[model samples]
Target: MNSDRLFTRFAIGINAAWLTLFALVPIILILIVSFLKPDPNFFVLMHFSPRSYLTLINPIYLKVFARSLLLALITAGCCLCIGYPFAFILAQLKTRFKPLLLLLVIIPFWTSSLLRSYAMVILLEAHGILNSFLLRWHIISQPLHLLYTNTAVLIGLVYCLLPFMILPLYANIEKLDLRLIEAARDLGASHLQAFGKVIIPLTLPGIISGTVLVLLPAMTLFYIPDLLGGAKSLLLGNLIQMQFLYTGNWPQGSAVSIALTVLMSLLLLLYLRLIPKAQRSQPL
Candidate 1:
């Protein structure tokens, strides 16, 4: 028995060590590289310098970072507004149909997000089906400039991240005790009051989780912004890509990447702290 226990301990230690090496070490490497000076050849130096971070103070990069944050916040808000209703509906579904409904929610994920964004490009173009239909219906005389704008970027982002927001909410809402809602009604609380006080509070943790999931990726996403925003509304992700690929500034790119990672970590910490401890411990 002692030998078996010792072997189990050794196995767990080995797995933990492997994970630290593979994941933690690379992150540390990036942090270190971010502080290093860049050589003319674009390779990072062994010695550390603050120059890369200094470059981040430039107005252009600052604006891009701010825009990225705003876009992410809006995307998270949109997802919450839309996803909550869908999740609520799914929660009320019959048991026999619940799995099918969930499968439908997950089906779009099987296709690549890039493909979906590209499809949006085709649909939202000036002469695309959406604009043509609207024109034919006399909604407007001219095709709207829907593609290659910030609005298009937001639409694409919301489309891509909707599932992430919905699934967590559905998980929580589906397990909610229907009796509690009825009990609130019995206590003379109106439907709106019950939902606002009881139902919304109960689902807060899931909402927070989904917000973090959607916000983090939305902030750093490059493809949708590049395709939909027309490369004019530059974002931090685009700046990072340009630094590495276009400008051949590896250290600067590494610095931007590190900053982004740190910002995301801070946002996630804030989000987690907003959750009440009791709700966090609740069973999903």
Candidate 2:
């Protein structure tokens, strides 16, 4: 009994240490830095100031924040629309072939996300394969301008975040009790009614999980816009990147980072409230 107790305490201690080192420490450091006065030559001054947070209220930065929020919402919505149907189909597959279908979903992840974004660049370029094929079929008199547009950025985000949406949805749908659907049907629920009243309620957790996963990353993945949408399509991620890397404004960058983290936390809390009280108490 003592040995098992010791082992459990040891595991807890290790996890606490890991969280302190990786999560808590970084957040504390960023919070501290966000209040520091930035110096162009020295990076930051020891003096405490709220200038970094004050700068966030500027109209230009507010616009960027709104744009990032809009893009993240659009990306998450698109992923849900695409992923739900795909996940439903996947869940209906035979047990023997299910692994193969899941493997296909996982295949694209083997390559770096940056590499995948670059590949989109090639495909969306004016004279790229899509446009060339369209022109060959006389679809248009000239190649369409597909790259360096909001559409391109949306495409890249959807492509990158699709897997995050699908995996959670598939897990939830796979665990659904089909008998409950049949019972609902026997009660005179039509196909759409059963789906709306039964399947959707049961799968709500997965939908929430997938949306949170896609939305958080979409808000911060600046590279997709940089590669596909160009400088004209700057988002909050780009703003943060420019502050730290090019402008050497650590305080402002840290402030942005903290703001984003807080926003995500609040959003997550709101999403949790939508879950059933019982489910909220259970493991995700």
Candidate with the greatest TM-score versus the true structure? 2
Regions of model 2 farther than 4 Å from truth: 1-24, 276-284
In the range 1-284, model 1's lDDT, one tens digit per residue, is 99999999999999999989998898888788889888768477788798999988998788889889899999999999999999999988878988998899999999999999899999999999899999999999989998988899999999999999999898888779999999999999999999999999888888998899899999888899899889887788888888878787788998999999889889878976998776665443
In model 2, the clashing pairs are: none
Give the worst 10-residue stretch by lDDT in candidate 2. Answer: 275-284
**TM-score of model number 1:** 0.86
**Which 10 successive residues of model 1 have the least lDDT summed?**
275-284
Q: Estimated TM-score per prediction?
A: 0.86, 0.87
- Cα deviation of 138, candidate 2, in Å: 3.6
lDDT of 2 by residue, 1-284 (tens): 99999999999999999999999999999999999999999999999999999989999888899999999999999999999999999998877988988999999999999999999988989989889999999998899999999899999999999999999889888888999999999999999999999999999988998899899999989899888889687787888888999999999999998999889999889787876766544333
Q: Cα lDDT of model 2 overall?
A: 0.91
Q: Tell me model 1's lDDT, rounded to 2 decimals.
A: 0.89
